[model samples]
Target: MNTRTRAAIIGGIITSLVIAVFAISLNSNIFRQSNTQQNSIQNNVGITSKLKVVASFFPLYEFARNVGGGKAEVYSFLPIGNEPHSWEPSIQEIEQLKGTQLFIYNGAGMESYISKFMSSGEFSNMTFVKVTKGITLLKADAAEDDKEILAQGGMDPHVWNDPILAEQEVTNIKNAMKNVDPTNAQYYEDNANAYITKLNTLDNDIKTGLSHCKKDTFVSFHNAFNYFSNRYGVHDVWITGIAPEADVPPQDIQRVIQIAKDKDVKVIFSEDLVDPRLANTLADEVGAQVLVLSPLEGINQTEQQEEKTYLDKWYQNLHNLRMALECQ
Candidate 1:
C-alpha cells in the first residue's frame, strides 16, 4: 500500500474508536441519572414521614413514640438510662435541636436546663409539649410529719409512674403531634387511643392484683414513686428523698430497718445505675431481699437493646412491688 493510503486508514480507525468511546461514556452517565431519579421517586412514594422529635428523657420519648408511630423519628436528648437531672447537653446536641421539629419534656421541674431554650424561643418553630399538664397532683404526704421535709413542698413530678397520669402524658403527646402535623391528626389520635387502652388495662390489673395485699406500704431507695403510690392505693417509705442521691443518713436507714421489721416488708427496692450498697446493707440489717424497681427515667444500654420501654419497666416495677408487698 502507498504511505498516504496507510496514514488515511489509521486516521479513519482512530476517529471511529474515539466516537465509540464517547457514545459509551454518555450512555453510562444517562443510566446513572435514571437510577438516581428512580431512587428519589421511590423514597417520595414511601409513607408520609412525620417531623423529628427530641424528648428530654424516657417518659417523654415513650409518649412521643406512641403518638408518632412509625411516622416520626423520636430520640432522647440524654442517652437511655442516664440520669437527666445532672446531664448537660453538649453543643453538638444543641445543634441537633436545630433540626428537631418538636421537643417534649416532663416540664414540672424536670429539664430545668432546657428552661432557657423554652423561654427564649430559639425553638420557636419546634412545638414544645409538657406532658404533665392537667393531671391532678399529690402533695408529699411523707413530709407532712417531718416539718423539715415539709418546708420543701414542690409537688412530686414523677407522675408517669401512675397509669392514669401516664395516659394524660399520652394525650399531651397526641395533642402536640396533632399541632405539629394537623394533616395526620387521626393517626396520632388512633395511636393515643391504642396506648390509652393498654394503660387502662394496666390500671385495672394493678388494682386487682393489689386488692388483697397484706400491707399497703413498701420501701424504696428513692422517693420517685409517690405518684404511683397515690394512684395505686399503696404507700412507700422512701429511704432517700427526691434527689436519688439523698444519702440515707444512718438514722434514716435505721428508721427504714425498723419499719420493714415491723411491717414484715421482705423486699427493699433499689434502681438500676445507682450503687445498691446502701439498699443491700439495709436488706441485710432487716433480713430482707433487694430487688430492682426501675423508675423508667432512663433505660440502660442493655434495656434499650431488649426493646424495653416505659411500659415494660413500669410493669416490671409493678411485679416487683407485688412480690415485695406480698400482694395476692
Candidate 2:
C-alpha cells in the first residue's frame, strides 16, 4: 500500500474511536444529571412525592388511607387477614419503619411489641402515632365469669369495635399525617371529617337496629366486645375466655351452652379469622345456628377485594346479632 493511503486509514480509525469515547462520556453525564434531579426532587419537593406511612394492621391502614386521600402511600405491617392480636414483626418489617414518614398503630395494648420497637432508639426521624390515645380503655376480664385472673396487661385493645372510639382513632391518624406532611393539612382534615361523619352514621344505625331486639344477650367465641356491648346496651357472652387457650375447658364450653340455652339464643357467634370448631361443637350441643362475627380486626384479602368497609362489616354484625337475638 502507498504511505499516503495507509496514513489516511490510520487517522480515520483514530478519529472514529475518539468520537465514540466523547459520545459515551456525554451520555453518561446526561444520565448522572437525570438521576441527581430525580433524587433532588424526592428530597426537596416532599409533597410532590407521596408520604411514606406505615400502619401496624388493616384497620389502621384503612383509616390512614382514607385520611390521606390518595396523597400518602400507606402500607400495613400485617398483611390482610392477619390476626393482629398475636402478630409480631419480623426484622425486615422493622427495618422498613426507618424510612417511613409516619408509623400509626392502635395502642391500648393491641400491638404488644411496639414498646420494644420504641426502645430500640433507632428510626428517630419517623413519627410514631398511637391512634388509641385520648380514649377510654376497657379492661379484659380474664374469663367469662371469673375476673380474678386478669389477662396480659388486663387492657382490652379492641376499642376499634366501638364506633365512637373509632372516630377518635381516625382523628389521631389524621392529625399525625398533617403533622408529618404539613402542606396537605387541610386535605387530611377534610378527609378525616368526612370519614368521621360516616362512622357517626354507622353508630346511629347500629343503635337503632339493636334497640328493639327481643333479647340483648348474644354469644361470642371470644370476649373482644366489651366496648361494643357497653356502647350498644347488648350483653355479649363469649364462649372462650378473653385469651383463648389451646384446649378450651369443658366448663367454659358448658357455661356458653348454658348461657345460650338460658338467653334463648338462636345463633352462637364465632370470630371470622379464628377457628370456629369449638363454637360449632357448642352450637350443635345447644341446637343453635352458628354465625361469624368480626371483631373489626384485620380483614382478609378476599374481603378487601370485595371492597367491604368497616361499616359494612359492622352492619353485617348487627344484622346477625339481631337475628340471633330475635330483634324486632
- lDDT for model 1: 0.78
User: Candidate 1 — worst ten consecutive residues by lDDT sum?
Assistant: 143-152
The Cα error of candidate 2 at residue 85, in Å, is 1.4
Leading candidate by TM-score: 2
- Tell how far residue 244 is off in model 2, in angstroms: 4.8
Per-residue lDDT of 188-275 in model 2, one digit per residue for the tens?
9999999999999989998889888788888987777999999998989987666543356788777888888888788888877888
Give each prediction's root-mean-square deviation over alpha carbons. Answer: 9.4, 6.8
Give me the displacement of residue 186 in model 2, in angstroms. Answer: 0.6
User: Please, what is the TM-score per model?
Assistant: 0.80, 0.82
